[model samples]
Target: MIGVLVTFTQTDKFDRSTLAKIAGELRGPFEGMAGLRFKSFMLDEDGVQARNFYMWDDDEKGRSFFTEELVDKVTGIYGVPPKIEYLDIVGFVDNSGT
Candidate 1:
């Protein structure tokens, strides 16, 4: 599986509204994509940090969505640029989407 950790430092002017917009956008559709096998998200005000935690079925699926509208929505809302890192999910918790 392909696990990608998408991280960013929020701009000084970042607001809750923008985070809300991001959540809305990510939960929607684009580029014929449908699902994220597994996902999580986190934000740290003290560090001005935000991350998009994801685990897709494979590299192709992951890259396909990243190159699609999801990337645009992230860039549009974050104000500043972001960085991404790829990793392997050696272990994870799954509750059948509970």
Candidate 2:
């Protein structure tokens, strides 16, 4: 598995409510997305940052999803470019079925 962390540090231009609205609008595309195991949108209002965490079943698929064009599009939406990091998922626990 692969973990992708996308951080946006332009919270000065967008408040928590705005970020929440953006997340709500964008959440649908990720639902049932191929190769995606899980996704979360996060907010750090006090620290002035917004972040998205994605877990993908395949590293290639996760890495390929974040293209330059996608970065540019997200930059336009958040009013700043994001810092994206890809990580190896050593282990995880899921109890949603329970």
Measured against the true structure, the TM-scores of the candidates, in listed sequence, are 0.70, 0.93
> Model 1 residue 91 lDDT?
74
Q: Which ten residues in a row have the lowest lDDT in candidate 2?
A: 10-19
Q: Going through the candidates in order, what is the number of backbone clashes in each?
A: 0, 0
* Cα lDDT tens digits for candidate 2, 1-98: 99999999863555878888998999999999999999998987475888899999999999999999999999999888999999999999999999
Regions of model 1 farther than 4 Å from truth? 11-13, 30-35, 45-47, 68-73, 96-98
Model 2, clash count? 0
lDDT of 1: 0.70
**After superposing candidate 2, which stretches have Cα over 4 Å from the reference?**
11-13, 45-47
